[model samples]
Target: MTPTVSGSRLKSTVAALAADRFAGRRVGTPGGRAAGRWLAGQLRAIGASVTTDEFPVAGVRELYRTPEFAWSAGSTHRRGVHRRNFAEHLVSADLPAPRTGELAVADSDEWRAKWVLAPDLGVAARARFEGAAGLLVPRGTDAEGWMPKMIAGPPVGALPVIAVRTGLHDEMARAGSGTVTASMPLRTVEVIGSNVHGVLREPAAGSPGVLLTAHFDGVGDDPQQRLPAAADNASGVAVVLEAARLLAPLLPDHVGLAASLLDGEEAGARGAAHHAPNVRSGTYVLNVDGAAQLGDGAAVEAGGPAHDLLAALDQTGRETGVPLRAGAMPSDNRRYAAAGLPAIGIGMGMPGYQTPAETADRVETATLVAATRLVVATVLRLAVHSRGLIALPHKDELQREG
Candidate 1:
């Protein structure tokens, strides 16, 4: 279940993190880390047991490394080829003496030698990545790679090699058509990072748990630039922090409310996925993200056993006159739902999402306060009143998918 909180207090909290100091809260960036720390602090102040759970992830290379390779015709291709001392590790290889060098354009076997070079990186071309030596990629050539588009790093899989300018390879070819050694020192490994938490223990015996969740990572504009996730999530983190302070003590023991500010929502759900193993059953999750702006607010409804909770929220909004609407999928709500827990997302709407315009123009302080109050009230009621499994109608979309 959820807990009851003061609206005024939550609004003030949201404003503080949205300030410039938080620096847009982009995930994995300094500003984003700072915001996460700030969120943990707020929860701790409310007397919750805060724990930052760190997980490891693979970090791709910042620059591509290509080494020159040559062979003396009929010298018999080298048995094994691999990049060493590169930024990441060599996980697996699909071909030996992988294709990467000047090769007779006509032979299929020659394609393997050419494979060492990063090709145009089309879907069909990458299929050959495993068979090549060093990829003979054209320098200054703008070609896609075989991997998801990432803002910070290189493609995650395959062996190592560098793409060089055709001129450079041509020069090498002229030097001696013999055997040229090709290699790239690439490394791949999991690095440790964390998600901090603050917990306000409910009175010893009330009900199941209610988690007020938010992800602190920000992926901002500027492919090379860090995301200043101010509105993307710093605002939401701030609100969750403040909510914890006012409502922690009031929560009954049977109804525990955890102010769970998450991490790594940016790098493909790393943090949430890590924490999933430990979450208790029968929990209710109210996730907040991209809600910093104060425009006409929105409330995302959880399809199961949480509809009455929405009604209470509607009542609170009507009473407070804060403009709160209904929205679709947001953040951590998806994770909880997948775990079979009742969950919903609530926030302020951003117009041009994923851009600077997505940020909050105003705090819409009253509306935020009203929304928090509503969630808290509903949580308490569900914790105390629902006798059996109280399943609400799943939202239209969730039902259709089911």
Candidate 2:
């Protein structure tokens, strides 16, 4: 009989990881480090041989305080809420000090030293406002008034960019000559991130093993509020932990089980990039992300020489009555795939991704249980096949045969 994963345990684990003390689990912050320590402790408690891989990451943005934005039209003034009303761009430049300027439309020359408010600004418009005080764009929001949190991307223009709610933008538009003042103080820091590794069983020489992985880091919270990235990642980590606990006693000697709780996934997948090259060549890797809100079934994306592994996963899903389908998940599994390893990425669902509304309460316990069951079942199926596993031909061997 397969060991059961307790729903209460899964819920508690998610609660612990998504608690306020973790401060959204951002890579370089004190809260992030605390979360890592907590995870390491949990892995050790599971009686698995645990270790950590430490690495240095640079150019990580740390939000120090609540960014402020206010617009004044003559004698009337209004302030924008941090997350609900507006949010700072991920790559926004640090304001040396508070700056105030009149709100002007994009096409007007008055945007020289003023806050340029527009529905959308194209590349040419961005170049035109290279000397402007700042740029403000109106963005759509969900029913709860939550806007999409920005992620770090390519280099932006010199002027800082901020996104405000469409209502706020309309208000600013009505105040044709309103003065807008904004402040977003930030600091770039070099920080050490760690990947927690726990081994359930050691593989024999020349024996291929299975790896379970999930990223635990999230977008750090703003000064005034917590992001509580429960669905984005904590849900997945909870499932992995439960699976490890249940599989420890049943893993076959020739087939090893290893789990990695990675960091800096939100910061351009730095943790995955650092780990992929070091993975043993023939190891099978499965990365679970966003497993909280399951919609019909789990989404699985496979790459490289993973025919046998994918087939086993599909079979296990069918036998266990869990739905599985092909989908695109551009996550840590890609790192392993790039290194010629058989890799699969799994995604269940994420309701409020990278936003403040992603609370622990939103996580579905039923989804968590199903995801954990699927992983456990898949691992057991792989173990049974490992005894007679035939290695796929190498590229060189296939080319010679052709």
Candidate 3:
């Protein structure tokens, strides 16, 4: 009989991950560690031997306090709201106290503690300044006017960088020169991340085996707001768990399958980075990044030597009536691909993305069912391929070759 995933179980799992107690499951936090243990327990319940690999992650951005920013251009003065009119940037320098400086368009001038109006400071952009109080870069908001959150990016502490909404930035630009006061309570810290691996079954001799991966960490809750992170990745993890629950007992006895619930993804996929090198190059890896809102099709990105695995997924998708399209998924799957493993990343849709508006209610049950079914079917197909590709050589053919 074909295995089927329980949609109710998947939904409950998503809710558990998005619950306020997990505090958005940021790596190294109590909430994050608890989440890892909880997932390990779930795997144990599914009759899998679970183990954890600990890895160190550095330069994780933490917003200790909401920033205070106000500016004046001769006659007009405005105070901006956090995540609405302005938000923190990853490259911001630590500035806890209030800082006041004159605003000048970022250029080849000696800034000398003046705040500059610059959008992005690449290596080329950074070379143009020496000492600037901070930067006010124009940033776009989501359709709902919420600035998405990020816990990782390029290095910080070069200078305080703040992202301002386009309208406010344009106003500051039209004024030509302005005075500004801002405070950044943001800091970067080092933390340890743990990856949970569950062994569902062992591969038969010569089988390449199959691995399922998903990041369970979110960007973490805002200091004051609750960012459920139901879609960004909780949905993906839920799908993997449900797929594992359904596929373990039904897979061919010789076929090997395992699930990797990763961490530090919000801070740059450190969990996968650490886990990838230990995996063999020929292993087939399938990573689910998002499965909350499936639109017309699911996005699929193949990396490394993934032709066979991708083909299997494509065939399975067709048979299951889940559309698949080529697209980019910059998630944990890329790390596995980098290690020369056959890896593919899949994403359906993320309704609210990384903003506080990302609630559990928006995740679609149909999408979860479709995603789980797709994963289960693809694993079964790959198991068949494993058996076919690694069969014993015919005695006559072997003798003739010899």
lDDT of each: 0.52, 0.80, 0.86
Error of 2 at 267 (Å): 0.2
Cα TM-score per model: 0.58, 0.90, 0.91
Error of 2 at 287 (Å): 0.8
Per-model C-alpha RMSD: 11.4, 7.2, 7.2
List ranges where model 2 is wrong by over 4 Å: 74-77, 119-130, 388-402
In terms of lDDT, the best-performing candidate is 3
**lDDT of candidate 2 over 91-118, digit per residue (tens):** 5677757789878886676557778886
Summarize candidate 1's per-residue lDDT along 150-196 as a digit string, tens digits: 22343544544344445454543444333435544333334444688
Superposed by TM-score, candidate 2 places the C-alpha of residue 62 at a distance from the truth, in angstroms, of 2.1
In model 3, the runs with Cα more than 4 Å from the true position are 73-75, 107-111, 122-130, 388-402
Candidate 3 has its poorest 10 consecutive residues by lDDT at 393-402
Q: Which stretches of candidate 1 lie over 4 Å from their true place?
A: 1-24, 59-191, 203-206, 220-226, 294-326, 351-363, 383-402
Q: How many residue pairs clash in each candidate?
A: 61, 0, 1
